[model samples]
Target: MSKIAQELASASTNTEDFYADLKPFANFEQLTNFDRYLPLPDDWFIGVADVVQSTRAIEIGRYKAVNTVAAAVLVAITNALPRLGFPYVFGGDGATVALPGKYLDDVRYELARTAAWAEDSLGLVLRVTIVPVSEIRAAGHDVRVARYAASENVSYAMFTGGGVAWAETQLKKGEFAIHRAPLDAKPNLSGLYCGFGPIPTEQGVILSIIALPLEDQASYRALVADVLTLIEFSSRRSGHPLPEGGPLPSWLGGEIQRLLSRDSPHANLLTAAADALRAIKTRIVLAAGIRIGRFEPSKYRREMWQNTDFRKFDDGLKMTVDCSPEIAEAIEARLIFAERSGVCLAGTHRQKSAHLTCYVPSNIQSDHVHFVDGADGGYAAAAAKKRRVRLPRGTNGHYRANRSIDAGERPHRD
Candidate 1:
């Protein structure tokens, strides 16, 4: 009816108030039955950043490092172009961000820098690719998307139509692989943090799972609904899945306050130094527990909320959860049941604690978000588990039967 809707239906991407239109469907109640998300216009781009040979890295105990690289791309890009708004979805190994055409060059600069840093600092092969939306449409796919606001301060971009997936496939195939640049400076990752280890909980356990859908959207949606119902019950019986006191310890907040320089990458020496001074001052204030310029625990908590990059939807459903032991058991049972009943392909992993990686904006104490995954292995491991299921394909074209370990079968998490 309206121009935006018309453009969306016709595969034209518009970021202007994009999430506002989808706010009504942000929660599971409406999203499970919604018609479809909007499609992107030709004037947009899709970026996929990931660690090459990530599975091998995970196997070799570099899983957390891999996550750093994944969130690093988003942090670098967003910091580089703060004025331009975009939507991003985090995969445990990498991330997918969509934005208008104007941000492409800046995005490339940051991605190159990030890839270089991953290789240089972390010894991980980070791959990045940026392709125009038109290229995807030409390949006979669409990048339909929805905004899922998990909390009041956080919203993730969910994708359908297979275009975003196609782009990722291309990147994996080395078709559009953007390589690392030889830069003297590291990617601007000032506020990113990993000093705090996994938050301890009573009977602490992290549950990671992936559920792939068949073509029948309703069936898959229903399956997600079932999973949510279990989680809701568990939350009522136990506490919220997120850490209750927001990852304890007095020095924790200070440990995460990074000094960021907001001067333009092209700024003069004087401006750069001034920005650096400002950053150090802010970090000192935050680290010392002084509340100036909205720099306090409440603000930090919101930053964490905005960046809770655990639950996401792409070709499959993925999440890294922390819950009470009993709750974890009940949720696992439901996944097994869903798979056995032909709802979707199921892949799951259980661990002691969830992994956390952060992306703090140029401001040390504000505009930060934390990404979470299962500690030993997160989404990447779960997806690997899903791939091993040699089950019969159901009518929905998904691998049938659940491959999740029975709660009693393994005590690896316990």
Candidate 2:
């Protein structure tokens, strides 16, 4: 092992509080400051899960299904390892999570099961794998993480360094591959759903952007900061895609998807009826802005909007914003200029509106998180555009980043 890896392996054994113990920053811009991040212990493992042929799926108008399966990776792992607080990022078509070595077997099993479940239940192939942090260090990459507290009840994980991007590249190359479990295998996907309809743009359009540094990290950070400044200056809520009170749930948007994700292949009449009733109750509560038992609909709506992961940094910067045509054009022009100047590689996609997928562990809790993307194609399309650009030799290439929702220095306000 490398000397840094040796030190990391010996530095600490108390892994339970690895993420919980880190001091979190409230400002999202602090993500560009490397000092805010801490390196993971070498004994930790990074797990990656992604849907194969996602572009094909998205092309056929199954973006919501794609988002749900991607979110399922996080939901399943979070539900399985409830006691441990680990950092994870949600890419539009996949997710990346880091955990201690002790839970490797458990996580691997869950990932395998999740992959199998996706294939059997959702008809999407999920590729999953777990790699050791020490190996990553030995390969001259590192995984450094920071916590951005978007709200009191939720803090999203921000990842820096090149380690995450590297692991993903390896997974795509068929290294450290984890085979899917038996068809009967199921992951704990209790809280996963894509219940809301596509969010109509209040401004003009929904834009998804993915940008990565092509040169040094310093220049990249500066460029990202400038991009963020443009985005913040262009809109009231820093280009947040959701409305003030959060999105209204569609009458039967996610019911079938939820039923399909259950343990059984077929949902019986009673189970389907129960699920529909629950959906109806939820719609009534949110539509009427009423408090049912411990659940406060209005407060939940506000928190949900505040906690949506519309902008984030995994290995690089990824954002999905709602803005007018002028702002979107200006931002695109700036990125094109940056790409031409050899500062970064970037791609963007625009749609009529934005899509949301949720993992609400409970309706009453303020900690629930929602994932955002362009309703038409979102990050997947943006990434495809980015890939069309020819990368120089030794270029790190594109990798999916984290998905935790965070706010910038200017938090979204009603």
Task: Candidate 1: list runs displaced more than 4 Å.
Answer: 1-26, 183-185, 236-240, 249-294, 302-307, 362-366, 386-414
Output the number of the lDDT-best candidate.
2
Q: What is the Cα-based TM-score of model 1?
A: 0.77
Candidate 2 residue lDDT tens string, 1-414: 754446457555786677888898888887778667777887789999888888788889888888888898999899998777889988888889999898999899889988998888779999888889888867767788889887788888888667776677677768999999996788888878777888999889899987766655667777788878888998768999999888888876574455553447575777777766777777888989888788888999999999999988776788999888898898889889887877777788899989898888887777899888888988878766413222221213222232211211100100
lDDT of 1 by residue, 1-414 (tens): 744346567542455545445543456444444344666666789998877778788779777787778888888887787765577877878888888787788888888888887786678788899988888876656676777766665566777655666677677667877778895447777567654455544456777877766455577777787777766666542233356435532232322222223223554667555654655664465455567664575556545644475676665576666666787787778777876776666777777777677765543444467788877776766656413332222112233333223211111110
- Candidate 2: worst 10 consecutive residues by lDDT? 405-414
Where does candidate 1 clash, by residue pair? 12-41, 13-40, 13-41
Model 1 per-residue lDDT at 26? 53
